[model samples]
Target chain A: MLPTPKKVTVVAGSGEGDHKLTAFDNALLAAGIGNLNLIKVSSILPPECELVERLDIPPGSLTPTAYGSLVSDVKGDRIAAAVAVGFSDRDYGTIMEYSGHCSREEAERAVRAMVEEAFRRRGMALRDVRVAATEMVVGDRPGAVVAAAVLWY
Target chain B: MLPTPKKVTVVAGSGEGDHKLTAFDNALLAAGIGNLNLIKVSSILPPECELVERLDIPPGSLTPTAYGSLVSDVKGDRIAAAVAVGFSDRDYGTIMEYSGHCSREEAERAVRAMVEEAFRRRGMALRDVRVAATEMVVGDRPGAVVAAAVLWY
Candidate 1:
């Protein structure tokens, strides 16, 4: 039996040009969470609800206050929230990437922060997260939505 | 609101694609198939399962065969074997054509035919399906694990 288990959540992000969506899915699954097991996480996000802003945004133009406001707009409708995710892959880091519009330095920092938070919340450690994947894709022509997902064990 | 209620189902020739997966999810919601849902369908064809030489291939290679196989697999796993599949569109057609492989006509015919046998035992009519969108994608790769979800109201 394996010592570690991976978890993943599938977020349908915009992929107008680049294979960003699939890439993201791949990243999460590679991180060991591509199981996509519905029984593990069915409808994590509510159906037909406006998404709120990130509770924490990477160092970027996305203002925390603005992000908080966006959250308020979506907080009312957020229905499908899940505490954990499922995976098909034995590892889940294949699909992770840096956050969007942020420098690599900032992206790495963001990941570190997230890892810490995940550990604090779940009592897990960075070493335990064997596979890891992250991304930060920006829209070339505009009118794109910035969304992301996290997978860990 | 519109007068006619909608019935939709998105069929993924391969289960793990981004657009097709997204469209399939949207179709299920459009069909108003209660809250029934599924995630990452496990391929019934085992790792050692070999492709047999068949003089008679279904209209769509990804036809109800794999999907039907998937249904039976799900049923075998304790879900209901009695399922209904309603076809709305073939979003992957363009990709198939662009790959310089299957012509648009051949691609469309394939998905349409597949939708038929998928629901054969359900006592349902393929024509009764409400197709919302069907587009062909060109210049693509091959070998996709197909998947479909049926919602019964």
Candidate 2:
């Protein structure tokens, strides 16, 4: 019999040393992001250098929700700093020119606004997020993970 | 836009308190057959039990892999475990019996044999596994996670 798939949530731009979050923390393994600030400062690692290779192929992926003015409404509470993972600038451009309903520019602007607001709400800065890795989940279903991870933090 | 789903691998099983596994060691979460002795104990949880209930639901489910099996083909030192996970038992059963051109019992038997071989190859026994909880996922395309998790460990 086929076993069902395991669910994955990718948190965007979560630092490389997320404390209290080691795999042993909750018997949970993580993708690229980490934040180990709570450890003795000496134990802390740079976000960019600390990236861990994923155990296997990146699973399925989802286009991240555009961060926008509404970001304050959605992630103002829990997020510190984040980046867009799936959606790209080209897609944003196409959406902006021909599609009046919503455009690529709109999407980009929304993401920018959300990223800023999320950071501001947490008293953080863009530079604080040193690296952004595009999580490519290649398989039958790919997009949900992008959403879950961003939403988690 | 929809967000992507991330794939993860977590082994869940119920824990047996005995410092050493005895033949009588029984797991609260295990549902299948196993000898009582030749036991090695670990603290683990069984797969989620609500998998069946959740599998039948439509929108989203927390049920982990509803169907799981591992078929083996071992010739001498070449041992392999063919793993599969499905949305539910019915979904897997039909494929095994009809599309796969194998009897239902045979498909199941193949999986069991392969799984046993896998344990043997790892120098582990079936009785050593202590399942904890089944992690579940629900989405439009949930196949990759299923495959990744099943083949991972």
Candidate 3:
């Protein structure tokens, strides 16, 4: 552990660009994590971590993040992404990420249930779960939707 | 959860398709998890679970899985995805996922380090870490690569 992440921020964004990869980068920029080196990691909310609405990360930092994203070049197609984190007062937390051809609410609901079910599997009680999401409808240009859980020290 | 996930399997695959969405499905099919409903969940390898190379899953079942995937439309562009799970003798395990325009081995090494870093953050000693990955270069069609950690009851 370089430094145990003491805080985590959930972010979601949608963007349009000339190409698929550029659309993804634009989405990341909209989510406020575009500049950092995103080290895609799995879902775990460390103990006693604080949840924030926004994150201010250093550029070029190795950020451990869990994310779901979709990019589409087809017109009129919907792309959605969602992330949820379930936490208990006395236990570590669970995280979930989902993305596909769906609405933001549907994606959010699915991931939330996943987090709750994960806690249930662990035989732990969850106080609450928080969700973040993004959606986009592809048009003439490539579009992307992204949902992410960013871990920070 | 309905029943606690007692077993986990890691899988990786790559595929090509006419479109980005189809490329993703083809990748999943190559990974042997295409028919099932992938319920995306966070990275907690439950205590007392067994790790296996291949999974015997019933079709249409809701499987809790954590994955990283990338799709590219550029010809000759390389894409890679990797997943790593860190386990200890007396503790729950942690999982990490990574995907990008890189080689498979590089992706695997980055994810493995992320898993070890996660365990270290928790002040836990890791007995070992297991890794799985896939990579491919796009040709005329869109290409996708995925790596996953699937949890089963």
Candidate 4:
């Protein structure tokens, strides 16, 4: 079993590169997370963890995260990504993420409804919800955008 | 202010496109979330929220979410992304995300430590945690990977 993360943060960034791959790396770098290895995982916040604002991880460190991103080579094409977690006064919570071809406002509104529906399905009363997101249009060069909920030891 | 999300879900997907942007869209579709708009948000799972296995969002509906993604055109290069949330029985939680060039295991380990340290700083004891992630080696065509925490009304 993997070690459980104690605290978490939210982060996002965007960049352009000579190639789609490079653009992604540049975006990670812009988000201050370019140099490390990333391992993907599912959702489930541990009990007792705290939330923070920044990811100060060292370069080359293996990092785990949950996030959404977009990379496009089509000029003038709009891309967006967003993440949100809903929490009540109780100890349980739910998480959601989305990415697509649209404006940031459109994306945010869509995800918000999803958050509310998630709570309704669980029959839980929500107290507050928090979010982070990014949006961009493809230019002459390949571009990328990202948003995430980051966790750490 | 938007309505607070009561529940959230995490998701991730990967795909290859003729171009980098299409690759991201295809990946979102593969993850079963391509049809909706995405709103980015930060971490913080509401207390008492429940975790579900799949997203049954309607097509063309707006959705709120938090996520990380990448698209690469570098052939034979490995890429990965991860997201995790930690929660205690208490009323708080933490989230983390990572992306880079490496194996999935390496990234997962790194993020686990990040979670631990995050809690250590907060002086909180962790009871449990959950995660989502993805990894792939790029081929001749462009490829993408993503992980996310999604929320709904």
Candidate 5:
């Protein structure tokens, strides 16, 4: 079996760039997680994983992450992204991601609700929840917003 | 630095389900990879990684993968997905994914071309190339096609 991640961190950021992918890259950079290669995973936090304040991964390393992002090229368009992590007692946690043409608060609320729903569906009692969110308004160039739960060994 | 993957496998499958996500899940199961947690990564095969005929990962393990998938709800519609890996003599390889409303042959051609383009852009001498693809026709339920390069320790 592959080793489970021991540390996790939540981060959010927004940015504008020349193109949509670049905008996304810039948003990830703003979120302080642009250097590593991100492997996107579905919502699941292993049991006994610890929440950390920051990640110290090297460039080009393969890093597992759960993220939500939105990009828009239309000027003045608002975009938001958020991620929520729900913890349970002595069991695995759940992660939820959301992105939409809405406010940061709305995105956060939606992701939290999704986490709660996931916990309910699993019959797990939700002990705590943590959220991170970001919003961006497009300017002359493409804009993007990203929120992520980064998991590492 | 995080440990790099040492083994890789190419797999493809198609399936039908009541919904899109389940359709995708069924496709993964058909491909023999549904039980694990997939971490989707961008196009890169680590240097010196060996190609394996199959993966032997445990259930619920976090498996890194590069993949392409297509889902269709319209009855009689055709969906195809393909993934290609281009290898260099002693350097990291490139992986390309493509999905479209086309035949499996067309999808395979497209993905292989993308891998060639990637090699050309990187100024790398391509030593070999491998591809996997799948196609599906939608019926009463939603249908999905998936092609993936599974990476493991």
Candidate 6:
């Protein structure tokens, strides 16, 4: 079995590039997690995982992450991404992500609601919710927004 | 850095369900990997990784995987998914995935081409290629197909 991550961090950023994938890469660079190979995981925070202020993973390391991202090529298009982590008092936490052509506040609200619903479905009491969100308007080039919960050792 | 996975397995399956997410879930179940938490990784097989006959993951374990999946709700729609792993003689291998409204043969070809292109770009010798593919025609309920290369300890 893979080891559960010991630390997690929330981050959000926006960037622009010539193409969608490059725009996403720039967004991740702006978010401070561009160097690692991200393994996208579904929204489950391991039991006893600790929240950290920042991530310090080595370059090219495999990092498990839960993320929401949106890229738009149309000029003036509004795009937003958000991620939320809901803590439980006595068990594992839940993570949720949202992305759309909307405002940052709307994206954040959607992710928070998703986290709440997830916790409710598990019959777990929500202790706290940590959220990160970003929004941007596309220009001539493609623009991307990314919000993520990075889980690491 | 997170530890590199030592073993990998390829599998494919198709299933039907009431909703898209559940259809995807059912597809995973049919693939014999429904209970594990999948962490989606990009196209890279760790150096010296061994190919295994089957996965033996415990329920709820975090499993790193590279996969392609497609869900269709339109009746008579043909959906397909495929994953390919291209091994190199002296370095890490590359994985590629594709999903679309197509036949299983087309999907497999597409994924194999992607793997070859990835290896060429890296200037790596293509030692071997392993592929898994599946296709399904949607009925009344939503249908999903999944192909995955699961990486484990």
- Top DockQ model: 6
Error of 3 at B128 (Å): 16
> Which of candidates 2 and 4 reaches a greater lDDT?
4
- Rank the models by DockQ, top first: 6, 5, 2, 3, 1, 4
Model 5 lDDT per residue over A54-126, tens place: 7899899878898999999999999999999888896778777889999999999888877776566557799
Question: Model 4 — interface RMS deviation?
Answer: 15.5
Instruction: Tell me the native contact fraction for each prediction.
Output: 0.02, 0.13, 0.00, 0.00, 0.31, 0.33
**TM-scores for every predicted model:** 0.27, 0.21, 0.54, 0.50, 0.63, 0.64
DockQ of each: 0.03, 0.07, 0.04, 0.03, 0.21, 0.22
Counting only residues 3 or more apart in sequence or on different chains, how many pairs clash (N, Cα, C under 3 Å) in candidate 6? 0
Q: Candidate 2, residues B26-111: lDDT per residue as tens digits?
A: 22123121221111111111222112211112222322221222221211211111122222221111000001223334433443
Shift of residue A35 alpha carbon in model 4, Å: 2.6
Regions of model 1 farther than 4 Å from truth: A1-98, A121-153, B1-32, B38-153
Alpha-carbon DockQ of candidate 6: 0.22
> Between prediction 1 and prediction 6, which has the larger TM-score?
6
RMSD per candidate (Å) reads 19.3, 20.0, 13.4, 15.7, 5.8, 5.7
Tens-digit lDDT track of model 6 for B27-140? 887888765668888859999999997889755468888999998899999999999999899989999999999999999999989989999998989999999999999999
Window of ten residues with lowest summed lDDT in model 3 chain A: A1-10
Q: Tens digits of per-residue lDDT for model 5 on B13-123?
A: 998765554566578878887656687889699999999988897554688889999888999999999999898998999999999999999999999899999999999
Top of the candidates by lDDT: 6
* Best of the candidates, TM-score: 6
User: Where does the lowest 10-residue lDDT sum fall in candidate 1 chain B?
Assistant: B91-100
Error in Å for residue A151 of model 4: 1.5
CAPRI-style docking class of model 1 based on DockQ: incorrect
lDDT of 1 by residue, A65-89 (tens): 1000001112122111112121212
Q: Considering DockQ, which of the candidate structures 2 and 3 is the better prediction for this target? A: 2
lDDT of 4 by residue, A55-132 (tens): 776432334577778899999999988777676567666667778898877767776787789889989888777787
lDDT of 3 by residue, B1-153 (tens): 246788889999998765564576578879987655465777889898799877886543446788999999999999999999888889799989999999999999999989988998999999988888999999998889989999886
| Residue range A2-103, candidate 6, lDDT tens digits | 787878899999999988999999999999998989888865777778999978899999788989899999999999999998888987787778899999
What's model 3's overall lDDT?
A: 0.83
